[model samples]
Target: MAKEQHKTNAMRTLDATGARYEARFFDCPEALSGVEVARRLGIDEDRVFKTLVTEGRSGAHYVFMIPVACELDLKKAAAAAGEKAVAMVRSRDLLPLTGYVHGGCSPIGMKRLFPTAIDETCDLHERIAFSGGRIGCQIEMAPDDLARVIPLSRADLIVL
Candidate 1:
């Protein structure tokens, strides 16, 4: 089971946005991705977002929101966050920093306000879905609206 905090990143995100959303669960593999989620929910791959935490040489951590089908361009991510280089953080560095596990990380409610990045690809749609601080659940809302709600570094972070 995940945390028992009762409040999760998804809940905080929705609350911050004042957006209505629901949670849907499934018997998922430990490592669930947006691709699998889109299939299960019968939604487009572009509509399912993935939450990832990254870091730079400076040891600054960042939370990035992007679609599974799309890749996070390091250069673009750096540019968006006004940094020089951005890369995936080590597994050991993730849990303590984000206060969440890597597999079920969310872009909201972290212990600290790490920089956040949302792929501009999501802007094409009115609503998009992302992990709900758990393995098998997701939350959906308007992309632009979501950006405004969460503290995010908004830009084109997708290379594909």
Candidate 2:
């Protein structure tokens, strides 16, 4: 028998949006960073993205996706988001704000649809991977497809 796959909220959202993706699962009972996740999954770090939740000066929340190995450039992100300044939300507020835990936040299914931006580097790959709204699962799909599922725009959000 094949191992059963857990369908996360992220996956379900993708299905509802008719987005195409391949789910990837790994053993992770504890929270792990995006780079660690890519290493464990044996995928290139550049092709793995991490979801970050930030609050702008106006107190509105925003989401940004960047490559696992890179950091989000606050200045660039703020500029792209048209916010005077932005800072990451506390980890404790993650679940309540996004309906996702620290390591399992996916850009696809958030509690509310916040303005989202993805690093322009994602365009270099035909497909990229992101958390599947769960700690041990991930979803791989074309960047264009992801934009269809989420109201996202791509920009130079990553730090040089």
lDDT of every model, 2 decimals: 0.75, 0.90
Clashing pairs in 1: 116-153
- Candidate 1 lDDT: 0.75
Index of the highest-TM-score prediction? 2
TM-score of candidate 2 versus the correct structure, residues matched by position:
0.95
Model 1 regions more than 4 Å off:
1-7
TM-score of each model, paired residue for residue: 0.85, 0.95
For each candidate, how many residue pairs have backbone atoms clashing (under 3 Å)?
1, 0
